[model samples]
Target: MAGGLGSKKVDITWSTEESGLLMAISVKTINFKDGKTRNYQKNLTNRRGDLLMEAVTLHRRFPYSVLAAFFFLDAGAENDGTPKRRSTFLNAHARLKLFTDRSDPAGREEQFERFYLILLEASPNSVSVRPFKVGDPDNEVSLSQMLDEILELVAERNPDFYEFDDGRLIKL
Candidate 1:
């Protein structure tokens, strides 16, 4: 949907549960803080893509265990600090799988963990967090920067495993 001149369509992607890597990570950008949600579905969906790319790249270098970390982060299964949905943003949901590498057992577990850790670290300031409050200190921290840091940490710890965007993960 376009709002006016120079406007752009909301980006989106599709995925499923049987994919066996990760699911979705929707990210929403609303005008004001509490206005209606537009492209809320796209937010999580694209974020999922970011995570899937990270895990697949890593699978070549690291063990399944390591890759799993990123996979789960994308899928949204490891929820802890995630935003609590209000009636306003509830209908804006979108779905996307983490990755479709559901062929191996070890590989699946690695993906799960990958999804888990990324969410654990990135939740506080995530786009999802916007529904709750407004201004804050940590909110200023860029999500892309955070993703990059996490990717670097993963690469540095497991040098023999995985590749990311310049050692950076794209934040949703």
Candidate 2:
């Protein structure tokens, strides 16, 4: 499929007879040192490119597939209340906007069907997520919405697939 490009192992993938390859999701996690701005920026920049390039390469071959992304950032708290961290966070997201529907996304790699950016703080348990758009970072998407997108796609493509209102999958 995908124009005969050798199979690329995505983080998640699904298919249906009607849709061929229907979905692909890739997840990447990066560590950021709040105290080490330079290293954090460099690593974030490089890693973002590494991950986005994979999606880009795949989407070019299968534009109809719902390409999704999940990015997790684990950052120390050395600059919590400081401007540096804010600037860096926005910058990272801005650069990331290149491959997402949130920003200028129509040059080569089309917009992803959905994109999520997650931030994990120094606290072992503190985590946050946001759609790839601007103006918000602490917001997280509900589990229901995530499942709905997937279920709806399946229901539309496969006669043997049925999804209940509560997101249960039942094969007909």
RMSD to true structure for each model, in Å: 13.9, 4.8
Q: Please estimate how well model 2 matches the true structure, expressed as its whole-model Cα lDDT.
A: 0.58
Clashes of each: 30, 0
Specify the highest-lDDT model's number: 2
Question: In model 2, what are the clashing residue pairs, if there are any?
Answer: none
> In candidate 2, which residue ranges exceed 4 Å CA deviation?
1-6, 32-39, 75-87, 102-110, 121-135, 150-172
Q: Which 10 consecutive positions of candidate 2 have the poorest summed lDDT? A: 76-85
Tens-place lDDT per residue, model 1, 1-172, is 1111222222322222323222222233322221244222334445555544554444433332223222112213222122654221222221323343233534542242322222222445563421111112122334455445445544443444444566553332
lDDT of each: 0.32, 0.58
Give the per-residue lDDT digits (tens) of candidate 2, residues 1-172: 3432445667788776655666677777766553554434556667676666666677666655566777666543213335544545566666676666422223456456566666556456766543333224445566566656655555544445554456675666
Query: Which stretches of model 1 miss by more than 4 angstroms?
Result: 1-36, 64-105, 117-172
Cα lDDT of model 1 overall?
0.32
